[model samples]
Target: MDFDPRLTPARSDLAARRLQARVTAERFVDGTPARVVVGLAPLRRGPRGDARLDTEALAGESLTVYDEDEEGWGWVQLDRDGYVGYLPTHAYMKGDVARPTHRVTALRTFVYPALSIKEPPLDWLTLGARIAGIAERVVDGRAYVITASGGVVVADHLAPLDRVEADPVVVAERFLGTPYLWGGRSSLGIDCSGLVQTALEACGVAAPRDTDLQEAALGTPVDLDPAQWRRGDLLFWPGHVGLVRDATTFLHANAHVMAVSIEPIAAGLARIAAAGAPLRSVRRVERPQ
Candidate 1:
């Protein structure tokens, strides 16, 4: 197909209007294959393979999804930064709903600015990159966000959604089997507090960084044996913290073996005991009334 530079200005205008329309309606085209680029400048020689998506790509603002056939694939355009590319038909959905979506798809954006990208998918572009975006809704205990450029970002990398009230255990489940990384905080990779923080934030709850900060933020420590702990309860160690999903299971991105995984509380505690380590503490983030 012949390229059209003349459409650039009109496309830019349409892009701007589209963004405003989505924001105003609080909706976006869902369930479609759209490619939103993550870069600063537009493609000079037209679209091709091996193009890179940089950190400042799309300036962390906008991206475009072009249609492949007649529209030449979903033309994804960013607002401040210019990132254009061709995405597969399976990349997106079509619709204008703001319902919560799972990061069943993988990418590098999250809700909070400080959260880290831990272990992203290898085949997926922009894997292991720290990204920032805002989560729109909470569904099934998970916070779904629209990527900075565009598209929905769910539990893959994450952001705390609401602080009002939440199911911490359910939120924690979003990270099941995630690999542990030091100072990491995304579905790509994550640490103890990163897991807790992301999970809590996704559910609209707030928590501090590190075990100490989280410890200080919670209300008076709940005094109960590990067996009595329930979902949403914070499980801590000297240098670790996690959210209990049940009496026997808790979730965390642990340094013990590194990576997010769920295990029986007794086994986890027993492992710590066997290693001659102390079981840190169990604190619960006060639920909003």
Candidate 2:
């Protein structure tokens, strides 16, 4: 049977011939678990810097290293989303994976060596990056969350591990004006499905990374009429998806505007129709009653 490389793990039978054969021959089964060390490690389609960027692994995210090529690229599967791709082997460090105690809620935050904001940041963390808090410190009346890795992050930028945002739309709207990047999953640059996935994940809702998988798995189908749509509804088109801002408006990260923007549902529909990618489906994620 045919398999989509994007959705299938490298250990599966449908993976590439070399990977399948390697797994079948018992050369490797479960790969080594590692943590991303850089700000944003590019996951590429091939074991080269010039290869197509499929996705990204944020700092502190867990991944399983399957194999490494001579070029120093490691084939891995992202633990959070199960996305398989190649990233430089040097970008990962195998060690005790700290249990995350909080998640970054800001578009981006800095990790400082001290509690003072004036101290130069040691690293930058994008939204959704998980952090393990080893201790809390107050320096000169400023509070900071100290991570197990000896990095300090602002307390206000992180939320407790169990805290889930009340509304996905509210979470999505915070990224308004973020620039569009085809495979980006951060507020610095994001795409249609990335925006949706980021928003839903903040609300403690799991989501797939790609539009087609999201369309197939997220939420349940609802009426296609814009009039029937409510806030937090998802509208899908070929290769795209958007969050319903309200009864008549939808928000999306679009290449047309090159940024996240809100547009009337009717106008968006007309524009997409003009491009021959008409509205395909409407899905509503049922909320707690």
Candidate 3:
């Protein structure tokens, strides 16, 4: 079988560079698809009696772009989490447009301009709102974000973007007290790697999803003691990740705490070291200014 596009050389240095350039803050409007097509309403199918999109496309596919009529009604291909199918253009909006843009956290903010104020994922906040104040990796890809106001939103969810170097520990600290959520990747609720990824993104750095993907993306491992570590240094063990806040402390989201929190890095390492887990690996990702 072919390699996963995310795993292959599809995202080259040139592409990575371009991603760094074009990623702006934005949202997705019309081009969305059901995570699964449960069933179809008549309007979802073409009026001229075209085949239903759900009947044709499989899960995790992409759709084509279509033209809209003067009345603002048209057929467009809908891509949902990689699944592409046909849907009405009217269902989307420029105000709701979702494309990839590289930007930092604007505020300790919330998603706005939404259908509802409560826990909505498609809601968005003002662009360029706050200074995320962290360092991210230097690579490129679209990011789905959550606003502090408990709203979900995807900014430039499809475009690629790159981040330059910044400190991971400083980045992690910004999200301190952020609640933990499974499969979450934003300031609202985040996982360990999600915490890492978002922290890096805020600092204009890039990292992969999950601990394993992130570990591989770091290129190679480095061995060093706490005294030798710096702000952006990353710490990892089996099934967990933490960012060095300094020589003594680090930040992470843990099920144990069930939210983003800070702790003594040396103490954590001491626990692990005493348990004889041994250090799986360590790496320092720094972006050149």
Candidate 4:
């Protein structure tokens, strides 16, 4: 049987105990749960610093850790999307996770030591990172949410988890000008699928973390004609995906521009087709009910 390594929590020597019957391994153990404690932790393909980044573990999200290797890397799967990778043990807390009350809505925001904005920043969080608010305070006519971990960040930068945007395209527009980072999941830097995933996620849509998975699962197929494209319609090529801003324009984070940018659909398609990857499919996403 074939399995996707990105979603499989198994290896020849160690595998999730739940898969004992389906996979053969030298050992099998149920995974331990942990919560991300750092602003952002790189989820890597391997345990070394030079390994390729698979994605990111955002602060406050829980993960199932199968192994805490000797070198301080945790073989884990992110709870949000089941993406399997290796994260440094220092980035997460060992135990159960707290339910997050609020999610970061800003492109980025600083964590402060106290309620005062004058305090030197302790850390930073990007859009999609969640936190449990222990208290709320109004200081100097500004609102602040005191995190359960005691960090102070602007209240306006966060929204209750239930609050969602009206459109994913609007959310994607916010990322324009962000530097492109392969495997990046934050507004600080992002990739083609990362932008789409982040945008749709903001609008309360659960999304897969990669282009191939997203293209296959996100939305039902639609006619491939550009004229049929509408806001939030996804366009796919061999290894890339982008959102249709309108009938005329599209938005994507691509290596070509090395940043999130919008361009005419015909131009983007022409350039990509010229490079040998023609538009393969169009998928229209439905608005959340």
Query: Against the true structure, what is every candidate's RMSD?
Result: 16.1, 2.8, 14.0, 0.9
Best candidate, lDDT-wise? Answer: 4
lDDT for each candidate structure: 0.49, 0.85, 0.48, 0.91
lDDT of 1 at 77: 42
Q: How many residue pairs of model 1 clash at the backbone?
A: 50
Give model 3's TM-score versus the native structure. Answer: 0.51
Residue 179 local lDDT, model 4: 94
- Writing each residue's lDDT as its tens digit, candidate 3 over 1-289 gives 3334332211222122223444322322323222211111112344244543222221112343433455534444334222122344433333322333334334233332342334443323322222111222222352344333223334432112344334556656767787886655555566787677666655555566567677777735667577777766778887677777776777788776799888887777787668666557777776646
Say which prediction, candidate 1 or candidate 4, comes out ahead on TM-score.
4
lDDT preference between candidates 3 and 4, better one: 4
217-262 in candidate 2: lDDT tens per residue? Answer: 9888999877788899999999999999987789999998999999
TM-score of each: 0.47, 0.92, 0.51, 0.98
TM-score of model 4 relative to the true fold?
A: 0.98
* Tens-digit per-residue lDDT, 1-289, candidate 4: 5689999999999999988888888999998888998899999999999999989989988999999878999999998988999999999997755778999999999899998999999999999999989899998899999998889989999999999988998888989999999999887889998889889989988999999999999889989888777899999999899999987999999999899999999899999999999999999888688
1 against 2, candidate with superior lDDT: 2
**Model 3 alpha-carbon miss at residue 112, Å:** 4.8
Error of 1 at 46 (Å): 39
* Model number with the top TM-score: 4
Show where candidate 4 strays beyond 4 Å: none
